[model samples]
Target: MPSVHIRYDNLKPAVKQVLFGRLRLESTRWASFKSWYQFSAFYCAPGEAGAHEKGGVEHEGGRFRRKHLVPPPQVDSLAELNERLAAIDVAEDARHIHGRPTSIGFDFEAERDRLRPLPDDDYDCGIDLTPTVARNSRITVRQGYYSVPAKFIGQKVRVKLRANELWVFDGRQVVARHPRLTRRYTYHDFLDHYLEILLVKPGAFAGASALAQARAEGGFTKVHEAFWAAAKQKAGDREGTRMLIEVLLLHRQLPAEALVKAMETCLRIGSVSTDLVAIEARKAMEGTDDDDAELLTGDGPADDAGGESAGQEAAGARVISLHARRLPPDPRTTLPDMSKYDRLLNLGTARETSQNQKGQGA
Candidate 1:
C-alpha cells in the first residue's frame, strides 16, 4: 500500500478551507505536533487501476463524490462541514493501511519522509505567544530557569523553547539559552545573566529546582526550628508543649491568628488537644450548630419532654457525677489521701470494732 502525507501549505487558505470542508482532519494524529500539520487516509485494492500512480487508495474518495460529483447536500454551514471533514480526514489517515510489510503499525514509519516537515522554529504556526513579562522577575519553565535580559524584567517576554532546550527571547533576538534542568533547587545558574533580578526578588524562588535548593541551603527549616524552640521556652514546660503542634497546624489552611486564639482558649481551660483546637476554630466562625453543642455538652433530648425538665437535667448531671466518681483522678494533681485511720473513720464504730477484732486475731 502506498500512502502520502501532503502539507496544506501550498494551497491558499480559501482553497484549503474548501478541501478541509470536503475531507476529514486529524488534529491529534501527532498530538505532540503543533496544529500546522494535517493528514488523511486512503485504501488500495490489488486490481484497482490507479493503485501505483495515485499513491494507493485515497481514503477521501467519498469526499470527492459528495463534494464534487454528486448533488452537494445542504449542511448546517459550509464552514462547519469543512471543519468536520478536516477532522475526519485526520482520523482516517491515523489508521494503519492494510497489506503492509511490517506488523508494527505506525503511519510515520511507512510514509516517514512523505509527511510534511514541521514548520521551522522561525515560522509563526499561529501559536498565541501573546507576550507578557514576569511580574516576579523570574518565571519557571520545566523545573528550570533561563534568565530574561535585564530590559525584559517587570515586563512580559515571549518564551520559545522546544523539548530539552529553552530560549528566552527579547522580541526577535534570543536573550538567553539554558539546558532545561529537572530537579528541585539545582539552580540553572545563568547567575551572571540574572543576578541583578535575583538581588531584587530574593524570596521569589521560580523553579522546583530553585525551591528545593532554597529549602536545602536557605535555612527555612532553621527558621521554623528557632521559632518552635522559642515558643516551647515561652510556654514554660507542659503548657508550651502543644506549641509544636500549633506550629505544624499553622502550615495548614486555618489562619495562624485563629489557631493562636484557639490555643489561648485551650491554655485558659488547661486542655491542649489538636482535635479540640480544630473544633473551637470552626465554632468561632460558625457558632456550634445544634448537633455539635449537644455532642460537646452531652445535652440530649429528654425521654419525658412534657414532664418537669429540671429532674431530667439533674439525673443527667448525676449520671455524669457517677462516671466522674468511677474515673481515676489525675496522678499529677492532689487528691484525697487514703490511710488506715481514714478508712476506719469512714467505716464507723461497728465496722471499726470488727476491724479491730480482725487485727487482734491476725
Candidate 2:
C-alpha cells in the first residue's frame, strides 16, 4: 500500500478518523524491526495492482481470528492465550489449505530447514513513552495510572509499554515495572515504589492503595502482616510501620521466598528486628537451591537499560507458602482454654457448661 494511518499518540483518538490521519510515511519502527528479523518487504505498485496482495493477507488473518478467537477464549493471561494459539496452530497443521494436496505440516517440513533462527536478543515491540510522574508517584499510561518512585514526582520518566507490561526507566536503569493495566482508569502499583515516601508518612501506609493492592496480590503475606503487627505493638503504629517499611526495602537485596521464610523464623522467635530479618533471610537464601530461587524484581529494581523488560513474567508473583517446608505444629498439644469458642452455642462462656449440655439444646 502507498499509505498507512498512524494512530495519534499510539492511542485510539477521540475522533473516529482512521480513514484520514497523518499521511503514511515509511514506518521507522518497522524499518528497525526488519533489520533485526533480517526480512525483506516487497510492496506492489499503488491502486488496483497492490490491492489483491494487501487484502488477502488481512482477510486470511481475519478468518483465522474469527475461527480461533471468536467468543473469546477464557484465559487467565496472555501466556495462556498464546499456548492456546500454539495448540490451534498445531491442530491446523494437520489440515490442507485450499487447493493444496499436502497438509500444512507436510509443506512446513519440506521448507523448515531453510528458516533461519531468530536473533539472539529479543526485539522490543513496545512503544517508548515519557509520562510525567504525578504527585501520587504515578504516571498515567493509556488512561490507567501506575506508580513510579516518589523521587520522580513532577518529573518525566522514560517508559516503555508493551502488550502485557510497562517498564519505567530512570536514565539508563530500569527502576520499576508492572503488568499493563487492562481496565481503563485503573492503576497497578507496587508497595516498594512508595516505601520511600511512606517512611516520612508512615501513618498513610495503613490506608495506602499500594499496601492494599500488595495484600490483594499476596506480595504482603500473612508473614509480613504478623511482623508488622508485632512491630507496631513493640513500637507505636507509626514507628512499627516505619520499621516494616525498612524491612520491606530489604526485598531489593533478598529473594522474596527467602525473605518470607526469614520473616516467619523471626516471628516464631518473637523478634521484630529488621537486622535479624535480614540475617535470617540471608541464611534462608544460603539453604535455598540457586536454580529455584528467582528474585522477585517487580517489587524492586530491574536490570540495567541494556535489557528490554518483558511483561510476560511482568506481574508480581504471589508468595509461595512455606508451611510444607517445615513440620506442621503438633495437633495434640494442649492450649489455654478460650471461653469465646464455647459461646457459639450460648453456653455461658464455659467448657463445663458446654460439656453437660451436649444434646440438651440445639
Candidate 3:
C-alpha cells in the first residue's frame, strides 16, 4: 500500500498526533502503522472543503450492502457470519464491472502480484490490558466475563483484545483465548478450566456458568448426565458431583473423544465411579481390552517382575495357574519298649517306700 487517504474526522487521535508530529497522543496503532507499513497518509481537508473526498468509499459500501446484505443472514456465531461474508467477497471477485474488459477477480490477481508480501511477524492489533482474575477464576474484559484456570485466581494477567477475540497471557505464555462477546455483561466459561475448583465445591458445579455453558454447547453429553445421575444414586449429591468433576478433569489428560467413549461404556455397564471412569478412559486411550480382564479378575502382573520387564509385558499377557506341593514326614522314627519303661517305674516306687520306712525308724 503506497498511501491511505483519510478524512480529518475519521483519523483516530493517535493517528492525528503522529501525522501532525505531536507528542500528546498515547501509544497505539499509530505507532504500529509508522513502524510496520511506512505508508504515506493523505488527510482530506476538513468539512465542506473535501465533501467528495470519500465518495468512492461510500459508493463501494452501498454497493456491498446492496449485493450481499439485502437479505440479512442468520448465523449462530460471529465466526459463521464472517465466514459467510468472506464467501460472498470471494464470489463477488468474479463479477465484471461496467466498461471493464476483465473480471474483478482477474484484475485483483494482476494487482495482487505487485503488492508487497506480509512481514514475517504479525502486528499486534489487539488492545493490551492487565486484569486480575477473581476468586471464581473469571476475568472481565469489555464487560464480558471469561473463565481461566482456577489456579490463576488473585493473580494479574495480561489480556489482548481484538475485534472478536480475547487472548489472556500469564507473562509471555497464553493461558486462555475466548471469542469476544458483543453482548454486555455476558459470560463465556470453559468447563475444563474450572474442574479443579469444582471438585472442592461440587454444589457450585451444578449452578456454575462453566457447567451451564458446557450443557448448552453439548459438551455435557447424555453420557455425562447418565453417569452423574447414577453416581448420585449410588452416593449422595455432593459425592456424585465430585465424581463427575473427576471424570471431567480426565479431559485435561485424555482426549475428549476417548473420555466420552469411556463414559458411554460406564453408562452401558451400570458402573459409575471416578475410579471406574478413569480406568475406562485409560483403556480407551490405550486402545486395549487387556486391562478389562485384569480388573475383572483382580490380578495384575506379578510383583517379582522387574519394572522394565513389567512395562515390556505383552498387552495380552494375562494367565492364571494353581499348584500345590507337600513334604514327606521324617523317616528316622521308632516305637518305644513298654516293658523297660514299666520296670524302671516299679524300681523307683520301691526305693521311695524304703526311704520313707528309714525316716520313720529314725
**Cα lDDT tens digits for candidate 3, 1-362:** 43443233346644444334222343567666656865544555455755586566667778999878888877766888899989998898889988999999999888886666667777777889998999878998878898889899999889999877899987889889898887899889899888887788898988887877888989998888888999899889999888888888878788888888788777765678777778777877787644554544546545444564455555645333221112356575887669988999999999999999999999
Q: Model 2 over residues 296-350: C-alpha lDDT tens digits?
A: 3233334443123443335632333232334466787788687776576565556
Better structure of 1 and 3 per lDDT: 3
Best first by TM-score, ranked:
3, 2, 1
Q: Give the TM-score of candidate 2.
A: 0.65
Q: What TM-score does prediction 3 earn?
A: 0.72
After superposing candidate 3, which stretches have Cα over 4 Å from the reference?
Answer: 1-9, 17-27, 51-55, 70-72, 289-362
Error of 1 at 69 (Å): 51
Write the residue-wise lDDT of candidate 1 on 214-275 in tens digits.
35544235433444355456665433434443444443557545555555555544455557
Report RMSD (Å) for each prediction in the order shown.
19.2, 22.3, 13.2
TM-score leader? 3
List the global CA lDDT of all models: 0.48, 0.76, 0.76
Evaluated at residue 103, the lDDT of candidate 2 is: 98
Candidate with better TM-score, 1 vs 3 = 3
Listed in order, each prediction's TM-score against the native is 0.25, 0.65, 0.72
Stretches > 4 Å off in candidate 1: 1-25, 28-131, 140-146, 180-189, 197-362
Clashes of 1: 22
